[model samples]
Target: MGRVSPPVLPAACEVLVVGAGPAGSACARTLAAAGHDVLLVDQHVFPRDKVCGDGLIPDAHAALRVLGVHDEVMDRALRAAHVRCVAPRGGHVDVPGTLAVLPRRDLDDIVCRAARAAGARFAAPWRFVAPLLDGERVVGARLRGDGIEHEVRARWVVLATGAAAPPLVAAGVCERRAPSSVALRGYLHHPELAATLRELQIVWHPRLSGGYGWIFPGPGGTFNVGVGLTASHASEEGGRASMREVNLRRMLDTFAAVHAPAAGLLARGELRGDWKGAPLRCSLGGARWSRPGLLVTGEAAGSTYAFTGEGIGKALETGLLTAAALAEGGDDAAVRARHEAALAGLKPRFELYEKAAHVNRLPWLADLVVWRARRSPRILRRMSAVLEERQNPGRLLSWRGMTKLMFE
Candidate 1:
C-alpha cells in the first residue's frame, strides 16, 4: 500500500529526483529551468564527505558550465593544465588539459545549491524507501525522514542515487551488483607537494595489473591520494574473490610506500583520515534504461568510464540528457524511449572504453604508449584528448591513430 500515516504531508510535483549529487542536480536544474516543477530529495545534507579522488578532468568542466556553476567551482578549486601519467616501467607523459581537485563535500554542495537556485524544491534527510506504484508504473516514491514516513507523488522518478543502488533495487529495475572495481581514497596535508603541485598525477603499478594510483592536489595544502582495481584484476588472484582476497588495504599501503611519486608525497605529510572504499557498478548502457515511469541516471545507470574509473562528467552529462528527454512533455513511454535512444550515443564510447580496460592489464603496452607519447607531441596531444573525453575512446583503436601514436 502507498500509504502515508496521519500528520505526514503529501506533495506533488512533475518530477522527483532521488539524489542531489551531480546527476540529480543536473537533471533537476535543467528541468526546473525549462519550467517544470521538480522536487529533489537526498538522504543526507550538503557539505558531507564522500569517498572520491576529488579530481575533475576537462569533461567535468563542461558539465559545470551547463549547470552555471563552472565559475563557482573554478574560482575555489586549484587548477592545472596537464596530467602526469607514469607507466609501470617508470616512463611518464604529460597530457595537456585542464583539471582541478575539489573535495566532494564542496563539489556536491555546489551542484545541489545550483539545483535549488534553479527553483527546484530541495528536501534532505528524506530517504527514498520505495517506488510508489500504480499497478506496474512508478508514480512517485515512499520516503522516510523526520521520524515520519510519506510519499512524494510525481509524474516521473529519476534515480540518481548513485553507487548505492537504492531506488532501482527497491523498484526491481536492478539488483545490488558486486564490485566491478574497488577504490579507496583519503586526504593528506602536504604543504611541500601543494606548493609545487601543477598537475594531477596517475601511476600504473607493474604488479597490480589493471589497477592505478592517483595523487590530486586539493584545495589548500591538501592532496587526494587513492588506488583502484577493476574487477578483471580483482578476479585474477582468485576467481570471483572480493577486495579482501586481493588484499586491497595492503595493496594501497604498498603502493603508497613504493610508488615513487606517491611515496615522496606521503613521506612528507601526515594522513588526514581513515581511507574510504567503495565498489562500483560501471556502464550498464546495455541494461534496461526504463521500466514504466522510472529512469536511472548517473552511476546508477552505469555511466562510469571503465578504463579510468571516471564517472562524474558522464553522470552530469547523462543527467542533462535525461532532463532534455523528460522536459519534452510527452507521455511516460515516449519520454522513456527518447531517453533510451539518446543513451545509445554513449555506447560506442563505452565499448571503446571496455577495450581500454582490458588493455590496462598489459604493462608493456602502457609503457610503450607513455614512452612514445613523451617523444611525440602530436601523440601526447591526442592522448590528452582521450582524458579530456574530447576524443572518442575508440580513436586509439584505429590503425591510423595507433601507427601515429607508435611511430610519430
Candidate 2:
C-alpha cells in the first residue's frame, strides 16, 4: 500500500470527492475527463484490502465501460469464471457467467491511478472531519491528515464514502440509515483452494435463512470466503447466533467436513494469517442522497444489490449517473429530483431480489422450485436473467411461462 501526505490549509477545486473507492474514483475520473478540476480523497492508502468476493459480473464490466476504465480493468481481471451452486441436499449445480476475479487492493489502486491520470488530484490517508456548510448548503469539507487540517472548497461535493456516508450524513448533509444485512469475509492462501480458482462455489444452506456462503478465488493461491445474514432476521430471538463468530464458524466447519474432510484445507490455510473479516451493509431506504451542492453515490446511498450483496457495479453506475446529473447544473430541488429518480428506477429490482431471497423460508418448496428450474433450460435462462438484473423478477414471475411452471 502507498500513502500520501494530506494537504494543509483550505483547498479549492471544481469538485471534491470523498472516499477513493470505486464509486469515488469513477466519479472523479469522469468529471476530470470533462476538464473539470476534481479532487478525490480517502481515509485509506492505495492497495488496501476491502472485504469482498472479488468477483466481477458482466454488469460490472458494463459499469467499467461507462467510467471509461474498461480497458485497464480488463487488463487486470481474470477472464473466465465457473460458478457452482450447492443445494441443501448436497447436490451442486455448476453455472457459468462471463465473470472476472480481482482483488480489491489491486482494483482500487488501478482505479485511483486512472482517476489521477485523468487529471483528478488525490488526498489519501485524509480523514473527512465534517462538511463545510454554507448554511443549509454544503460548500465543501474540512479534512484532516498527517496531523494537519485543511478546508476544501468546491462548487459541487460528492459523497462516495461507501456504507458509512461519513460526515456528510452525520452532519445532516444527507439522511443515513443502517443496512439490512451485515457480512463477514476473509482471505486465505491455499494451493488446494487455488486449484479451484476457475470454479467459484456458492453454498445455499437452510441454516443461513435468506443468505448463502461463498468461496471465490483470486490471483495466485488466494481465495475469499464469507457468509452473510439478514440483519432483521439475525437480530431476532435467535438472531445473534448467525453472527460470523458463531454461525459462520459452524457453517465453515460443516462445509469442510462435508467437502474436504480428509485434507482440512481451511484449517491449514488459517495458520498463515490469510484470513480477515469485515462487514457488508445492505442497501437501506430513506437515505437523503442529494441536496444543494451535495450528492451521494454508491453504498453511501444504499445502492447495493440486495440478494447477492454486490455493490461495486451499483456503485460505479451510480457514480457515473451522478456525475452526468451534476454536469447538467441544477438547483437543489432539481438535483434532488434527479437523484431520487435515478434511485427509484433501480430500487424496485433490488427490493424484489431481497424478497425472493427469503424464499428459503419454505425450504422444501424452494428446493422443488430450484429442482424444477434446473430441469427446464428455458426456466433456468429466465431465472438467470432475472438474477443478473436483465429482467424484472416480478414481471418474470407474473409471466405466462412462469404460470405454466406452477402447474407443471
Candidate 3:
C-alpha cells in the first residue's frame, strides 16, 4: 500500500471529507468536478483491504457513472456475475444480472484515483481525531498524520467514516439506530470454485438463522466466503461458538459433494482455511443524517441494504447526492432539507426489504421460497430485479409472482 504525503491545508476550503472510502471519494470527485475545493482524507493508505463481498450490481455501476468512473472500472472488472440462491432443503435458483466482481482494494484505489484526478486533494494514513467546531457549528476537523496533529477547516464537512461513525455521533453531528445483524467473512483460495467464480452463490441454511452464507470469487482464484446472522439470534445461541468456522465447514462440505470430483478438481483445490467475521450495520430506518455544517453519507448515514448486506452501492449513491446538495450552495437547513427529501424517496422500498428479511422467521420459509423460485422463472427474475434495485414494486409481498413466497 502506497501512502500520499499530506499537503499543507489552506485556511479553509469549500468541502472537507473524512474517511476516503467509496463514499468519501465519490463525494470528493463530484464536488471537485463541480469546481469546489475539496480535501479528502483517510486513515489508511491506498489499496488497503476493506472486508466486503466485492460484488458490484447494476446499480453500483450506475453510481460509478454518476461519479464518472464506470468505464474505467468496468475495463478492469473480473467477471459478469451470475447469482445462485440456495435453500436449506437443497433447492437452488440461478438468476443472471448485470453484476461484476472486483476486489475492494482495487475498486477503492480506482475510485480514489478518479477523485484525485478530478482535483480533490487526498491525505492517507491521516487519522481524523475530532471535528473542529466553531462554537455550535462544525467548521472542520483535527487530523493526525506522521505523529503530528493539525487543524483543517472547511465551510462544510462530509463524514463517510463507515460503520464506526466514530466521534461524530458523540460530537452530536450524527446519530445511529440499532443494527439488526452482524456478518463474518474472510478470503481463501479455492481453485475448484474458479470456474463458478462468475457465479455468486448464496446458501441460506436454516441452521444459520435469519442470515445466509455466500461465496464470492475474486482475482487470482481467491474466494471470499462468510456467513451473517441476526445479532439477537447470534447472542441467544452463544457468543463464542465460532460462526465463521461452522459456516466455512458447511460451505466446503457442500462444494466438495457437488463439484469436487469433476475432473480431478478436488485434488487441485481443497478447503483452505477459516473465514473471518465482521460486524454489519443495517441502515433501514429513517434517521437524520446531517447537522449544521456536518453532513453524513454511506454507512455512517445508514445507507446499507439490510437484506443483502450491500453498502458500497448505496454509499456511493448517497455520496453523489450529497455532493449535488452541496453544489447548490445552500445553508445548513437547505442542504439538510434536500438531503432528507432525496432519502425519503428511497427509504420506503429499502424498509420493505428490511421487513421482508425480518419476516422470514419460520425455519422453512427460505427453503420454500427458493424451491418456488426455481420452479418459476418469473419469480427468480423478479426477485433478482428487486434485490438489485433495477425495479421497485414498493410492496415486496404484493408482487403477484412472489405470492408463493408470501404464503410460505
Candidate 4:
C-alpha cells in the first residue's frame, strides 16, 4: 500500500516511455520483459487519481490477461453481472457481458507495478517538458522534477500522455489542439447501493443530448458516477471547439433530475470528493503515430472510443502494439511502418464506434434500440457483442441496422 516516486533519474535508456498509466506501463512491461532498457516516467506520484468511468469491459479484460495481470485485477475488482442501458424514454435493456470496476488509482498502480516487476525503471512526478531533437528525429526528452531539469536520452521515445493537449503540442505531433470530448465524475459511498447495484447502469436522456451518464458500483460500498458529452465539431472551425454552452455540473444535475437511479444515489450516498473532469481524445485521428524516433500510443493517439468513451483496453492494446513494433528489431523506417500498420488495423473498429456515436447526438435512437432489444434476443446479444468487441457496433447502430430492426 506504499506509494512513492523513484528518487533517482536515469541519464539514458534504450526506450523512454512518458505517462505511466495503462498504456505506458503496458509498453514498459512488454519491453522490459523482452530485456530492453526501459525508463517509465509520469508527472504524478503513484496511486494518483485519474478521471475515468473505471468500468472494465471485456476488451479491458483481454488486455489485462495479455499483460498477465487479469487474475490480479479481477481479485481487486468489483465484479458486475451485466450492463443496464437506459434510453431517453426510460426504456431499458440489460446486456450481459464480462464487466468489472476498479478505480483507476488502484488499477494504474497495478499496471505500473507490473512494469516495474518486469524490470522497467519507474520515475514519477516528472513532467515532460519537450522532446530532445537531433535534426528531425527525436532522441529523448527534457523532464523537470523536484525543481530541477534533467535530460534523459533514449534511442526511442514513446508518448502515452493521455488526452492532454499541452504534451502533444510540445512534442509537435498534436493534430487537433482540443479534446474530442469531455467527462465529469465523482465517487459516492453507499453500502446499500453497492450491495444492490450489481449491474453497471448507463442512462441516456434528451436532457443529456449528445452524452450519457453512468453509475458504476465499486468495491468498499462506493460508486463511480459521471456524465460525458461527445462534442460536435462539424459546425466548428477546426473540429476542435467543444460544446461552448455545455456545463458539465449542470449536465450532472440534469441527469440526476431525469434519472431515478442517479437521483436515489445522490440523495442517499455520501460524496467522497469534489467532482473532477477530464478531456478525452477519441476516434484515433488526432496525433501522428510515429515520427523518426518517437511513437505515440494510448489516448494520446486517440485510442478512446467515441460511443462509450472507454479507453483503458485500447490504451493497453496500443501500448502492446508499440512495444511489439519496436521489439521486432528493425530500422527506423521498418519500426515506423510496423507501428503505423498496427494502428491502421485498429482504425476500422474505431470508425464503427464513431458511427455508433450518432446515438449520443440523437438520444431518441437509444430508446428505439432499447425498445427492440427488450423484445429481441438477437439484438440483445448483438449489443453484448459490441461491448465484448466481437461485433461491429455499426451493425446495430447504423440506419441500415435500424431499418432491419423495423421489418424484423
TM-score of each: 0.91, 0.87, 0.85, 0.97
Candidate 1, residue 73: lDDT = 95
Task: Report the C-alpha lDDT of model 1 over 111-207, residue by residue, as the tens digit.
Answer: 9898888899887778888998999999999988867788888899998887764556786776434556778887888887788876888887666
Residue 181 in model 3: shift from native, Å? 2.7
Global fold similarity of model 2 (TM-score):
0.87
Off by over 4 Å in 4: 1-6, 232-235, 238-243
- lDDT by residue for model 2 (1-408), tens: 345775543368888998888888988998898888898988887768787777887678888877677788778776664466666666665555667778888888888888999999987788788778888888898888887888889888888887653554555744434345566666666777566556777666666556667777766676677665554324433332233234655655555555542125567765334445444545545367777778888777776766667778878888888777776766777876887788778777777766655543433434555676678777667656764667666543333534667776
- Candidate 3 residue-wise lDDT, 1-408, digit = tens: 354666565667779998788989999998998899999988888878786788888778889887788888878776665778776677777877877777788899999989999999987777878878888788888888878788888999888877664545554654433344566666666665676556777776655556666777766777666665553223323333222323544544444454322213334545344445454555533235777788887777767777777777888988888888888986789987887777667778677666566423443656666777777777777777876676653343434435746564
Q: Residue 64 error for model 3, in Å? A: 1.2
lDDT of 4 by residue, 124-143 (tens): 88989999999999999999
Candidate of highest lDDT: 4
lDDT of 4 at 56: 96
Off by over 4 Å in 1: 1-10, 232-244, 285-287, 397-408
Error of 4 at 137 (Å): 0.6
Q: Number of clashing pairs, model 2?
A: 1
Indicate which candidate wins on TM-score: 4
**TM-score, prediction 4:** 0.97
Give the winner by lDDT: 1 or 3.
1
Q: Which candidate order results from sorting by lDDT in descending order?
A: 4, 1, 3, 2
Task: Specify the poorest-scoring 10-residue window by lDDT in model 2.
Answer: 236-245
Candidate 3, TM-score vs. the true structure? 0.85
Candidate 1: how many backbone clashes?
Answer: 1
